[model samples]
Target: MTVIIFTVSVLCLLPQEVLARWACVRACPPSCTCTQEKSCSVLCDRSGLAELPKEFPCEASAINLDKNRLKFLSERAFGTLPSLKSLSLDHNNISFITPGAFKGLSNLVELKMAHNEYISYLHTRTFTGVKKLVHLDLSDCNLFSIPDRIFIEQTALKELLCFQNNFRRIPGAIRGMENLTHIYLERNKIEAVAYNSLLGLGSLKYLNLQENRINVIHEQAFQDLTRLENLYLNDNLLSDLPKLAFKGLSRLKMLNLGGNQLTNLSKTWFSDQVELEVLYLDRNQLLYIEEGTFENLTSLITLHLNSNNLTTLPFPVFQPIYFLGRLYLFRNPWECDCSLEWLKEWMENYKLVRDIPCASPSSVAGLDLGEVVFAKVNGTCVDPADLNLTTASSEITSTTENRFKSLIFTLIHPEFGDQMGNGTESLRNGTLIESEDGQLSAGVTGQRAWPSESLFCFIVMWLSLGLIGQSDLFFSLYCT
Candidate 1:
């Protein structure tokens, strides 16, 4: 009788270990994952499991159930985990979760229920008990709206990712979360941005609103986001930027505004973002560029201006960009004319940006406007009639050309002096060998039948006259 009683007690302990081993089996909860420690967790994605029996494995600390077909978390579904700390139910078919689903998990610190095919939504404070929660990723979960209480209760939360949702209007300001540092709300159907949307998120650092239908952004929408580092609003319809659009984003490091329909590049509109490091403005319909357009971006490293309709870049346009390292100008319609004269030296000396197509009339496309091509074609002079610059202006360019002619003519032959004296007084004084341009101009201008042809003739004439007179005198003395 004693041996039979001991065997019965030992048999009872076998079921407990078998149950723990069964947690990792394919029949686990839809939102639960079995960990390597032989513990069952609700954080695993078990969407196909329909019903969850009572008394699940209670040793779970982290549960992953992101992509499952669970509709709700009933009271008994989560009653087993007395020490659960992390629960991930994202990418599941959960449309509704009763408040009693979390009745026993007072120790839960992290909860994720995003990307589920949800018809309902998670309003504010839907996760009230999990106050110690630090990270919440609800991106692409079809969250239409959320109440203010969602962030107010989770004070210890540090990162909140709610991008690619179905939020329509300006929901609520993400205020009062003193520890929140990152927020992502990209690819949503947001139309307008109201003020104070981020009133008290002091520690918030990175904000992404990329690929959204955000038509308008209020001026002070980012009023107090001073700690913000990077902001992405590319592929949005940001028609015009008001002067105060970047009011309090002083610490912003990068801003991307590519793939838009921007016409004017107002320097004052983005003057306040002093600490910005990179700016991307590619693929826009930008036509005009005012002076000092990029004056305030002192720390900017790389600027991408590819694929725009910029026909011409005004003179002194790149004057303020002293520290600029690499500039991209590919896919722009560059009017390669006299205005590009200032860029010849830089192009020859270094790898300056010039990967653009010349605009209009199919006259000059794909032409690499370099020194040999433009100078030979005289690409600088827009019209021969505008050679109407001041006579003094003539003092500058022609001195070298004429001096070169004079020097080469002297080197080749003897008497052609009269034509050289016909130059203007100012030209004569400046074109002599004393001037800076005159010496270099001799080697540069090869066209004027050798420079100063008349000057060379005059020298030959005087020398011949002296020698002839001396020879006659010497002959007469020898005869005496």
Candidate 2:
């Protein structure tokens, strides 16, 4: 570990805190229990140290000054440590840091500055002497930012953990770390990412970007990382997957985009990823699945898609999954209708397994679409005594249609009295009088009268005619 200091103006007015720090740095005992190999790897850990140890003889390689009531890091407190590699300053109350405080360290490897108080505006050359630095972690630090020249001299950095920060934009200096391969920027306030920020080194392989407020990414932001593999961009406000966002990557395998505002996934979303294998799209507001969405992902094996709103799986939804073996469709509010008839044959005919487990919203929970939802759903009932064609019979469809027509008239025209029957010469022989209507109405068609009105009027007319004849005879008898 080497001393890292911002080589700016030196402190001229030494406060009492600085006076105490200098006293400890030069006059500490030759040996202590908390220090090892010229470094206090576990010192000042809430152990009888009300204030920070001002002086640590430059023999310690690593120090643990966390969970202390230290209120400041006086200039040169850690400025001259020639052998320090790692430092723990977590859980501290030190808010003030003089410029050039850590000016001479050139071998620092890991630095933890989590859980601290306001330290904004990292002056340029803040890490002046630390040239072999690697694994710099500032997670949970009350830091607004480091200067654009923070990683100016150190290039051996491989992993950076900076999640839970206040970064609102992609750090333009990130492209300077050519050897960096893994980056953790999750759970942050980032809103946008620029492609040009990652223009060099091309060595990033794993990117953890979960739980961010990101809504946009330049199409070419990831064009340089040829070896990139796993990408996690879940829990975002993305509505669509840009076509050129992953333009140059050829080795990407797993992509997690589960929590987003994507409404539909079409082939245009995956037109470039020919090597994608595992795709997780859970907890999204997707409404449609376009067949072409997976056309280029011929190597896909596992697809997780639960907790969505879907009415039916269209025929084209399953067209591209020829080699698919596992599918998860539970937790989705599926509206089963006449369209469900296709799912049964869709599984058996396509040799797909019919094992689906229901998730929340108990309305459709624990029920299998093919075996339970469809098999026992309200089915058609057959009228055994029906003179019309039955559903059980394979008779001509036209016959069934005609029978349905007759049933409709019989059931709807109840005033027709005996009008419900087939009315064939054989069926009606004992009923309605033939040629009851004036126009020789063979049947209830255009020339025939309506069943209800015609029957009622004809009956009245017949009764009146009979009364007229009787009245004439009665009058004659009276006259005699």
Candidate 3:
């Protein structure tokens, strides 16, 4: 009788809203705790809750029922909480959420139902009244299949995290969600990305498909994602790439393609990715790269090609990347031979934070390639022009003076004059080969031909120096 009188006295002393909140707290189930601070909250986590807590606070704005034994959420689980904004039911034994379970939480903005391994299926109308949801995390749920049009009503949803599931393909559940900007589908059993798989998600900018079994991707898989910026495709079974694999990603900035079985990089692999700044191709079996492969990546800043099987790179491979700020070429079996002279020069000239280490050539096996002494690189690779000059010099040394005069005559005038005439025809005809003006004419224009005078002077100079046996002097004076 005294307790009833004290309760009546406290109720009379409280304001109307406080009295109403007190009544709601009193109605809460004995096992759950209800708090009324700035916004009412219900905490029922790991409290052996077999079902949804009964008669939770009416003004509750958040409910946390994580790590519980709850099996299902029936209709009107939290009745008529118009201001409720967030709900988390993670790590529960829930296998199903009945339709209209969230019937009246109209302002719900975030829902976390992750780690519910038994929840392999979701009723289409389970999120019936959560129209304003913006973020949903359902990762690690072991979901094998999902129904279509499951998130069609969440027009404002921006992020959907569904990694570490059993999805064999990108779930068609988000087909009509145009506002979603991020989706995580890593650590799944996704084998391939079919054509138009992600059709309606135009606003999506960040996509993570790493750590999957994806070995193939259709050319038109990501055609509708015009605004996508960051894409992660690392740790997959992609042994080869299609020509137009990245055709539609013009504004892409970062791409991760590490840990694959790719044996080579073709010239046409990356398509329409002009704005790309960071590229990762580490941990591949790349043994060759076609010339001019990276010619179109003018805006690229950072490039990673570490942990490959490359023995040598072409001379012009990095010609197009003038603005490159960082480059990685470590862990390759670089053959430090004559062909690697260009690499030595590039290492000395191009500034890099990491030194390129050589893995071959016993002398420089463990040393940085920049420190190697390329003694045979200077003009050792003979030029064709030099070879022709050497052949001509050898012929001049073996020939007699008579042949030397005849050869000099042929150089001064077209049509070798005569094997025996020497300059006799030129002197008699006065050919007027304007030697001073560097011109050659056949008949005399006004004065005697200078070809005869020049030829006579060359013969005198050769005879004075006895150049018939000295091919080096002759080549230096004439071939030069």
TM-score of each: 0.68, 0.65, 0.71
**Per-residue alpha-carbon lDDT of candidate 3 for residues 1-480, written as tens digits (9 for 90 to 100):** 557445544554566678564654664556777777777777888898787754555556788889988888888766666757889999988887888888878899989999999888877887887899999998999689778867768889999999999999999888768999999999999999887679888898999999999999987677788888999999999998887788788888899999888999888766577888999999999999888788888889999898999888777876787458888888988776656676667667876635667777765778777776655325584322344466677665545444445446655655544332323432333232435575653333355444454555456546644555553455334422
Q: Order the numbered candidates by TM-score, best leading.
A: 3, 1, 2
Candidate 1 lDDT tens digits, 183-245: 888888877666767777778888787887777888788887879888888888877777688
Report the Cα lDDT for candidate 2.
Answer: 0.61
For model 2, residues 1-480, the per-residue Cα lDDT tens digits are: 222122111221245466435423343433323534433454556554546554454545677767766666655556466557887777776677665556656677877767765554456655666677787776776655556667777788887777777777656667767788888888877786676766784788888888988888888677887778888889987787666777777778888888888888866666667787888888898888877777787778777777777556765566576567666666676654434446656666755555544332244455566643333314642221221334334343433334334324443554463553436321122122235443222243223334454444334433433354443343223211
Model 3 TM: 0.71
- Stretches of candidate 1 exceeding 4 Å from the true structure: 1-33, 36-47, 52-56, 75-77, 80-83, 343-348, 352-354, 360-363, 368-372, 376-480
Whole-model lDDT, model 3: 0.75
Q: In model 3, where do residues sit more than 4 Å from their true spots?
A: 1-38, 345-355, 376-480
Among these predictions, the greatest TM-score belongs to 3
lDDT of each: 0.63, 0.61, 0.75
